[model samples]
Target: MTWTIAGSLAVVPAPTRTDLLAEPVAKALAALADPDAVGVAEIDPSLADTAAFCEAYGSPLEASANCVVVAGKRAGEVRFAAALVLATTRADVNGVIKRRLDVRKASFAPMDEAVSLTGMEYGGITPVGLPAEWPILLDRRVAEAPELVIGSGIRGSKLLISGAALAALPGAEVIEDLAR
Candidate 1:
């Protein structure tokens, strides 16, 4: 099945272990994505954020997934996780995430902290290459999508992959009601 905007974009083979930020994402792609199934497309860095990307590239909002870093603390220990949800909806941070992380509260991670820890730009944190210890909480809706667009751990490019491919990533955990 053709992905949204696949015909109108300049997609190429996804970069494999190229940069610190892309390293894990590349490895995830290699391990989980079918050959040639994961496509990469370059974009203006200024428009790399989700809303602008979909608007500029003619990608449907429903076909775009956002990976957000969330953090919470309990017993003086802080934990971080990446949450993947459809661009049309927001992750259920206060409820589902907090419960899953077993923390009193969960919130979007501070920009500096997220970037520094993930080694990715503030707006380009994807689940593919997250630290092995962090759980990749994927929304059921997103996991059910046939194809979707996601960050590539950098501001200038994005990855196009099927939901099955994403769900199969080593750390991915399908969570029902993960988004609202």
Candidate 2:
């Protein structure tokens, strides 16, 4: 099945476009309960960043979600997690996230660490293919959105998925006020 969303993106079943996704993302797509429900769209790799992608593709910022990798440490032990929030808002890393991780401090993870750990590209880390041990904190607003455009674990494509599907992902926890 083929459909269009975000103004100009021609979305196809994600499972059918594994070549457009990173290996991990493609594997995760096949594992979803309804893989066909998720859609994939190819785009220019140079325009993968949220702001640029939205502007160039005619997608709205409100419908785009960013997956941020965060790191929190306590007593020499480090914890890493992914925070999913709307592009228009910022994740409360020092507040809700820090508390959630039970650490004294929380901050964005280094680019190299994030990319290496997730096996995904730097500008295209999505929640779908993150490490299973890491928590996936989903802002309540994002969990309630009808549809969202997110990274495909590669800079050359994007994924279109529903809020419900995201909330149902492994390790996903819907948190109130996770972003502001």
Name the top lDDT candidate: 2
In terms of TM-score, how similar is model 2 to the real structure? 0.97
For residues 1-180, could you state the per-residue lDDT of candidate 1 as single tens digits?
A: 345655356777675424423656666666663746777887788988888888888888789999999999999999999999999999999999999999999999999999888877878889887888999999999899998889988888888888888888877899999999
Candidate 2 per-residue lDDT over residues 53-145, each given as its tens digit: 999999888999999999999999999999999999999999999999999999999999999999999999999989999999999999999
TM-scores of the models, in the given order?
A: 0.91, 0.97
Q: At residue 65, what lDDT does model 2 achieve?
A: 96
Q: List candidate 2 stretches off by more than 4 Å.
A: 1-4
Worst 10 residues of 2 by lDDT: 1-10
For model 2, what is the C-alpha lDDT against the true structure?
Answer: 0.93
**Residue 48 in model 2: shift from native, Å?**
0.6
